[model samples]
Target: MRAIIIDDEPHCISSLKYDINLFCPEVEVIDACHNGHEGISSIKKNDPDLVFLDIEMPAMNGLQMLDQLGGNIPFQLVFTTAYDKFAAQAFRLSAVDYLLKPIDTHDLMDAVSRVKLRLNRDVSRQFDNLKYNFGRPFAEQRVAFPHRDGYDFVNVKDIAYCRADGAYTTVTMADGKSTLLSKSLGEVTEMLPVKLFERIHHSTLVNIQFITQFIKRDGGYVVMGDGVKLAVSRSKKDRILSLLGLERW
Candidate 1:
């Protein structure tokens, strides 16, 4: 498989090439780029089968460069980064692989092997998810939910509340539409910003911005902008109230 490496650190680029030659002999190093801009231009020129990308760059980061592609990622991406925090975002983008700095030979081979197996699968959905959330602050992040045919990208601000049912969670949007996600509530909870979303009940998480009223009736329930009443668990009632700027003395 043809591949290119995009990293600002010259030593890392050289090390990756060495590892590929020794361990991942199936992959050929086509071009080594120093920045995202060069990576973009080289990608357009080489049209390689895989790209070893770096997350943090001077002008355009890896995600930013992918965003500029408009739609449909042209090649498989294996992100090489120093930060472990970027792993979540990388997987959300359906990246073929992620390797931290001081790339491991065994891990490199394993990632490449996975890439070879999934070269034909459609990763556009993953890209859509990345385009919405990558590099953005929690307040600006969006969530991707798989629907019947494609995926739904909803801004965090547009989410009213999330209801958990068994392994699935129903996400109610501000527009009165709800979508069912196959993921468990606990899994989805991690994707949302804690400051913007608060878990009120064991099965309910609500967007604090969408909450319009806090009723002190029957233990307590919060009224959303759409007039939907969500019951708040006793444990979370005080915290939820405090989050809404209503402190109980």
Candidate 2:
């Protein structure tokens, strides 16, 4: 894929270019721009297949440049940001991928691979969903997870619990449906709102609202509305009790 690298930092541009050439030989660097304006011009001029854009740039930011595109972007975008604050925004924009800097070689390759796969798919819906979410309150926001053929988007309140399955997570919904995610429990936990989801076990994260009853059996366990019993680790018992507003036995 023909691509452009846009970043204000010289070393970052150099490093990404070197990494792309060494690791992702499938992606060709067509142009490297120092700021967003140059990135826009390069993209329009070259009509590249992909673009590696930086979020924080002077004169015009990456999002600003994208906004100028009038939502009919022809090429895929992969955002590079040093700070994690922009990750949510990148996801909101339906970016093909997000690379945290100093970008790892494996991550860079993985991002490129995802970009290639998504190139054939329509990503405009995700962008529209994100735009809708931005206007809603945080509690009304939704989270998307990669499922069987595509992705499953669920409201935070609809999730009953999440269980760790080694490197993957099984998300159980209140309606009794479950979906396996390709992300680890730890990784997925970070994406969830802390106030709504609580870790009752090392491998389990439960939505506080779905707890039907807390049974003091096998040390301690919580019963979900769907009747799934989940054990509470001894270390987490007190914390869970505190969250439940119950007295510790």
Candidate 3:
């Protein structure tokens, strides 16, 4: 598979390259970039099958750069970082794989094998979904809920709605508690299973199961089981109504 390496640290990139060549012999390293800007350009230019990305870099961090790219990320990503503790939950939520720095040859091989399997099987489906929603709108793309102290879970189901709090999306759960997830609402909505969740408004995703009542207002609103009122955008009202089997009303 063709691949690109993106990291500010030259040694980190070099080590990864060596490991890929030595252990992951099937992976071809087409290019490498020093920062997020260069990484974006390289990805757009090469359109490689995979990307080895670093989380912290100059100008734009990995997550921000991914956001800027909108969707259709062009390749599968295996994030390489020294700090894995903070991002483990986020990675799990997105269902993306990652490798910790001071790289392990065995773990690298495992990650590469997983990538190859995905490419051979499910990559097309994932790519199509991401491409279809590239930059047209903003929706919750992922979630990170506190797990055990410092860890978190994506919890796509428990999320009833998400509100934009500047750069963060406040994910409101069915239980009435809220947590700040690091992705935008638009991105989250696109990444999530569309049949299961609908973006009723710019800031909300009302879980069809948790919706207790639908109130007709300026546009529409849903009263979730937990009694939280969430607004439904005019454009999405029909879809939400249809999903809830309330279209006849």
Candidate 4:
């Protein structure tokens, strides 16, 4: 499969390239980038099937780059880092594959094998679920909302809607206030109650209870109870209409 290596250290990239070629014969290393910005741009341009990403880099780190990708992240990420203590924890939390620095040949093979297994195992089904739930609503009540500093409790009913602002999500409250969340719209959407919220666009999720009116602009927009207008995607129009109990207008 096509793959790209992203790490700030040139030697790390060189070591990884050698390991992949020697141990994991199937993986073709198409390109290597020095930092997260170039890494992201390369991924967008090359559309590789897998990415070996380093956790820390200048300007944009690996996690930050993933956050910036939003719904458009094309490849399965295999984080390559020297952070030993957090490695096991990260894998446990997200089912993510990773390899440590000063790479071990056996570990490299194991990681590549796992990648192949996951990619071969009904990836289309996984993609389908991912698409349907891309920007699907959040169930705040059940989820422990995360802040940059730490986790906080958020009542599901307190949130009026969610707006994705490049690399961050703005959680608009019912009381006319907004909080910037560190999570992506997709990540936050999974935490929200789908029954109460629905993704109406690539960048927006609205509270079903707070919808004031369905304003059909030249494109389509939702008028909130507070007179705020939010854009809706054409792909989501049918779902939005169904939620509103209205036939096509």
Tens-digit lDDT track of model 4 for 66-162: 7677646557667887775423333322335667777788988888887886663322223333223323333322234545543444457778889
Q: TM-score, each model?
A: 0.71, 0.77, 0.51, 0.48
Q: What C-alpha lDDT do the candidate models reach, one value each?
A: 0.80, 0.81, 0.70, 0.74
Model 1: per-residue lDDT, tens digit, 1-249?
Answer: 899999998999999999999998889999999998898889999988898998888888888888777765768878888876544543443333578777888889999998897675566666666656656766666666665555666777788899999999998999999888988889777777666788999999998999999999887899998999999988998898789888883
List where candidate 3 sits over 4 angstroms from the true fold: 84-86, 120-249
Q: lDDT value for candidate 2?
A: 0.81
Candidate 4 clashes: the total is 5
lDDT of candidate 2 over 69-152, digit per residue (tens): 777677877878776643354263232367888899998988898888878565555555555555455467777676666666
Model 2 bad stretches (over 4 Å)? 85-96, 129-140, 163-170, 174-187, 225-228
For residue 219, what is the lDDT in candidate 1? 79
What is candidate 4's CA lDDT for residue 206?
Answer: 90
Off by over 4 Å in 4: 120-249
Distance from true position, residue 241, model 1, in Å?
1.4
RMSD of candidate 1 to true structure, Å: 4.5
* lDDT string, candidate 3, 220-249, tens digits: 788888887888877887887788887644
